[model samples]
Target: MVAREQFQVELSKLRGDIISLAHETEKLLEKSLEALYNQDIDMANDIISYDTKLDQKELKINEDAILLIARQQPVATDLRRLIIALRISSDLERMGDNAKNIAKSTIHLGEEHGLTIHPALTDMKNIALKMVDLSIKAFEYEDITLARKLSELDDLVDSMYGEIIREMLEETATNPQKIQHIMQMAFSARYIERFADHTTNIGESILYLVKGETLNLNE
Candidate 1:
């Protein structure tokens, strides 16, 4: 095969690896939320255990991307593709860490806390997950409009996060004994909010790859 053809193949494989990592991260986020909602210690532990797999997947993607750049010495659009892949993979890996953090928060809350999951918190999780999904789609399609839309979704997540925090603070004031549980719930909400922030980063990455300019969707 020609060198150009081989490069194309490697590029395609890199894209596939990124998509796989994205999907795995998304599932991890979903499971973490489920464990929090159900207060399932066992499930939370499993999610923590599964986080290592995401780490490995991310490492592989990073290594593959680096090797492609080294071997192909890609320039212009090809170079941009590899760079964006690296950025997206890093974002996805951090997103996985946030999910792991959420699982840890669930464990910290413990089964005996008897704390009810806040509806606003649930809304944050749902919107965060949707943002994750849409970010991947925007990257796959190179859709600037879809990528821009993620900031709007992220704004919603931020709004919901603030609502959860305010409500938790009010609850904590009324029931000082449950302050620890409330703090854990607040941390989980922050993690979800951060997860959405990373999704917005991916959206920014997509925009950069397509338009060759930097845009701060996080702001």
Candidate 2:
């Protein structure tokens, strides 16, 4: 009984640590997107630099979770929870990495041409940020309803991405010099789309926490 209680405490600790990592990664992504929107290369650079800190936190969380699993050999449900937490941590870390990649692209684009960003793309960017924010909120609060709504918001970002892609393709045809610049902008937009996807993944993770079933919003 005493050993079981000890294992429970370790599991709780691991869960808290995982949530912390998730929150930090979300912050990194938020700053990265803001840097892109505002054309703050310095802010983007800071976000890129901090991504390594998140990587370290993820490594530590992985080690701690693994150590607990080996030490406790948690039973079926507990094992599942731990595994899900590990997967969520991995996903969050990768999201941070993606944000860093987008920041680099933002810097490149900003340097090449003073961005003549369309208002429509700005709306798309805002929606992407909103989805990510709400997804994190849903996870922290375990609000399945909020998670469901994020799926709808993500669709808005998807539509914006499609519009921008088509516009860029047409622009490239008319003025070939703009191709490389627009392509980088398109890539930045693509990263945001993927970021929203990751946000939905977080929502799915929260759903799994509540229902013990996997929900893949992307599918």
Candidate 3:
């Protein structure tokens, strides 16, 4: 009984660490999008630099989870929890990378263009951020319904992404000289779309944690 109690404590700590990583990654993504909107080169640079911290957090989580598995030899549901924790951390880290990519897009865009961002792109950003928040909540509560909703949100993101790409393509045809700027904008939209996908991946992980059933939320 004492050993089981200690294991539960460690499991709780691991869950907390995963939540912390999720929030930090979500914040980084928000800042990255803001930097893109304002064309704040300095802010974008800071986000790029900050990504290393997220990487370290993910590494620590991975190590700690591995140690728990090795020492505790958890079976069945306990083992599933640890495995899902690792998967969630990995998805969160990838989300951070997508944010970093968005920051890089901002830097590449520079300030000289004074390009106006598309309204649809802003919509994508907002939905992506919301999905990240919802994903975390769903994981915390192990709400399968909430986790399933992420797929619907992903659909919205996908639609907006397609709209952005089509519009950008139109702009590129008319203003061939601005191809570079248009390309960067498209890349940023793609990054935001990928960020949403990762959140759905987290949602799928949550479903697996609770139901012990694998799902493809990305579809």
Candidate 4:
């Protein structure tokens, strides 16, 4: 019984760690966008440098989760809890990479002259950032209903992505001189869209943890 109690305490600590990682990932996303929107290459470079911190955080979560699984030998929902912790950590870590890629795009964008930031990209970034936050909340609260709502938000992000692509295509044909800048903005849009997909995956992971079901929002 003491061992079981110890396992619960460790499990709670794992949850706290995942939430902290999620918070850092959320900040990364925000700063990546701010760097691009404001044309701040130094801030963008800082985000790129900060990717190492996120990787270290993920490694710590994995280490603790593995130790708990091996020592506690949890069953049923307890086992699911540990598995989802690892999965969510990976998803959050990937979100960090997405932010890094967005930051890299900003560096390329900064070198170009006479280019306006794509308005639709900002809209996509706002919704994707919200999805990341809400998905983390859904996991923390074990709220399957909140998880279910994320797919709709993801759909909105997709629509915004579509708008950005159309604008990019039109601008490319009309203003060929800005092709380099336009393409970089398109890459940033893709990064944000991919981040939204990762957030949806986190929501699905929460559903699997809470109710043992699969949700494929991509379909």
Candidate 5:
């Protein structure tokens, strides 16, 4: 059963690729949050370095999917999984870009003005980070229940984003000098919100992978 052995080998490689990308995503989020918290330019700059690795991994994931399809002609569920791996890796790469964007914005804000960090946004960051972590676990375990739950949890981050935006607008309206700094803060919050959305997308992808039914986190 040489064919069977070959299939197993490829499957193992695919799983390895998925796990590596997941770990990379976690590191990206951690660095982004640490940069923001410390207002460290060097840490912000490091995102660009790590982004190269992410790009490479994305390319490998796509190439591997194509090879798997061409060689195996995987049917039904197997085909769906290969497709999901390709699709979800792209989403994960975009999430990493958003994390980079947040770090860049933090650097600019720190350089432009001595802006005081808002403690409340910490809640939103924590929520987004947790979402990413749980989404990975959901994928690794093929947990449909966790995928469904993640869909509902996104609203918590969304609500906090809205409230933070309102507070910033009110403050900026009263003090024109705060406009630029507040805008940077708003962008950072938006990045975190978008990050949460990507994580939810991963959750949805995992659900689809397991159940073959589309699950939208937006609902």
Candidate 6:
């Protein structure tokens, strides 16, 4: 009984750690997007530098969770929960990496040509950020229904991405000299779209937590 209680305590801590990582990644992504919007070179640089913190947090969570598994030898649901926690941490870390890439693109798009961004990017970013928020909320509650909503949100982002690419390519044809800026904007959009996919993956993980069945919402 004592061992079981101790294992539960460790499992609770692991869950808390994973939630904290998601929140941290959310903040990083928000700041990076703001930096991109405002074209703040210093802020973009800071976002790039801050990625190491997310990396370290992910590593610590995995290490602690693995130690618990080794000591407790958890089976069935307990083991699955710990395993899902590890997957969530990995998705969150990759989300952080995507944010870092967006920040880099923001830096690359320094105010050289008096750039005016596409309206589609605004729509795309909004949906992507919403996915991040909703996915984390779903995970916290283990709400399978809420997790399923992510697929629709992911679809919205994907649609906007296609529109952005089409518009940018057309604009590039006219302003051939600004091809480099166009590429950076396109890459930034791709990064955000990719992050949204990762967020959906998190929602899928949370759904697995609730239903004990894995569903690939990405498809």
Model 1 residue 179 lDDT?
95
Tens-digit lDDT string for candidate 6 (56-122): 9999999998998899898877887888888989999999998999899888899565778666776
Q: What is candidate 6's CA lDDT for residue 57?
A: 93
Error of 4 at 73 (Å): 0.7
Sequence-dependent TM-score of model 4: 0.96
Candidate 5 lDDT over 142-206, as tens digits, reads 78888777777799988888999998999798879878888988888898889889888988888
List ranges where model 4 is wrong by over 4 Å.
Answer: 1-3
TM-score of each: 0.97, 0.83, 0.97, 0.96, 0.93, 0.94
* Clash-forming residue pairs, model 1: none
Task: Give the alpha carbon lDDT tens digit for every residue of 12-127 in model 2.
Answer: 78778877777777677677767777888999899889999998988888888888888888866677667767777887788888789878977887754755754565676567
List model 4 lDDT by residue over 1-219, tens digit each: 365787788899999999989889889999999898889999999999999899999999999999998988888889999999999999999999999999999988775457888877878888988888789889889998888888999999998898889989999999998888889889999999999999899988988988876767554
Residue 62, model 2: lDDT of: 87
- Clashing residue pairs in candidate 2 are none
lDDT of each: 0.91, 0.77, 0.91, 0.89, 0.82, 0.86
Which pairs, if any, clash in model 3?
Answer: none
Q: What root-mean-square deviation over C-alphas does model 5 reach? A: 1.8
Candidate 3 overall Cα lDDT vs. reference?
0.91
Model 3 weakest 10-residue run by lDDT: 1-10
What lDDT is obtained when candidate 1 is compared to the true structure? 0.91
Give the 10-residue window scoring lowest on summed lDDT in candidate 1. Answer: 117-126
Q: Report the error of model 6 at residue 170, Å.
A: 0.4
Which scores better on lDDT, 2 or 3? 3
